[model samples]
Structure formats: C-alpha cells, structure tokens
Target: MESNILVIYTGGTIGMIQDPATEALTPFNFDALYKHIPILQNFNCRIDSYCFDPLIDSSNMNPSFWIKLAKV
Candidate 1:
C-alpha cells in the first residue's frame, strides 16, 4: 500500500535554509521541496504540503489555527 504524507509548514527552523544575501533562515518553499529532497520520489507514497499564510509564530497559534489543521 502507498502511504501518504502531509508536511505542514507553520514557521520555525524545521526545514529552513539561510539566505546568504540577507543571512536569514527562511522557510523552504514546500511546493518545490521535492527539488531539494529528491529521495522522496523513490517512496511509495504521496507527498503534499500546506503552508500557513502570514506565517504564524507557532507561539501565537490560536484555536482557529488548530481547527484548520484538524480539518486537514
């Protein structure tokens, strides 16, 4: 059976890379994450991602955000 994976990108240092010019560790674009980690292609699974707009600080997460995630 093929498993499915959902990568939820909120905001933090999980899969971030430093922008050499600005020296900022910004979040990697989830839509193009496969380009960075090609090994995902070999897996018997579906990989999808969801990004939070206006990116939350995680610490500021409220009940509505939790509800959105639960619905996913």
Candidate 2:
C-alpha cells in the first residue's frame, strides 16, 4: 500500500546550497528539491515537503518550532 509522508526541512546542511555568485550558503529552492533528488520517485508512496517561510537558522531552534511541528 502506498503511504503519504510529509518531510519538513528544519534547516541544516541538507537544506542549504552554495550560491554561485556569492559562494555562500543560502536557503535552497524547496520547489526544485524533487528534481535534485530524483531517487524519491522510486518510492511507492507519496512524499511532500514543507520549508519554513523565513528559514530559521539551526542555532535558533527552540520549543516554538517543536510545538508547530507537533501540530503538523
């Protein structure tokens, strides 16, 4: 049976990419994530992703984020 799963990116190396012009780490385009990781297509389930509107830095991780995550 196929299952649906939500993948939330909480901010980390996995969610960052080096900007070509400035060569600095920045929030990646979450919309294009599927294209970058085509392996997800092999799964027999549906996968969706959610990224923070104003991506939070890992240093600022706190209870608020956890509370929101729990609600989802």
Candidate 3:
C-alpha cells in the first residue's frame, strides 16, 4: 500500500533560500521540490504540500498558527 505524507509549510528556515544577488531571505519554491530534495524522488508514497499564502516566520508563530494548521 502506498502511504501519504502531508508537508505543511508554515514558512521558516526550512522553506527559505538566500538570494545571492541581494543576500536576502526568500520563500523557497515548493514547486521544484525534487530539485532541492532528491531523496523524495525515491519515496514510494504520495506527498502533498500546503503552503500558507503569507508565510508566517518562525519568530512570529503563535497558538493561532497551530489552530490554523489543525483546521487544515
């Protein structure tokens, strides 16, 4: 049986990449996930992702984030 995994991106270092030009942090494109994480290509399960419209930084996380995540 194929398992399933849900990757919820709440936005933090895990989902950020530094822009070499400006040296600024930016949201990593989840669309090209395989390019970043080749290991996922070997997975034998379905992987789904949910990214917040406006990613909440780790420092800004609170109870509301958990509430919202639970709702999803």
Q: Best candidate per lDDT, number?
A: 3
What is the per-residue lDDT of model 3 for residues 1-72, given as tens digits with 9 covering 90 to 100? 889988889888878888999999998888778787889889898777889988888889899888998998
Clashing pairs for predicted structure model 3, backbone only: none
**TM-score of structure candidate 2:** 0.75
Candidate 3, residue 12: CA error in Å? 1.4
lDDT values of the candidates? Answer: 0.84, 0.82, 0.86
- Give the best candidate by TM-score: 1
lDDT, model 2: 0.82
How many clashes in each structure?
0, 0, 0
Residue 66 lDDT, candidate 1, scale 0-100: 91
All models, RMSD in angstroms: 1.6, 1.8, 1.8
Q: Which ten residues in a row have the lowest lDDT in candidate 3?
A: 29-38
| Candidate 2 lDDT tens digits, 17-52 | 999999999877777867978898898988888887
| Model 1 pairs whose backbones collide | none
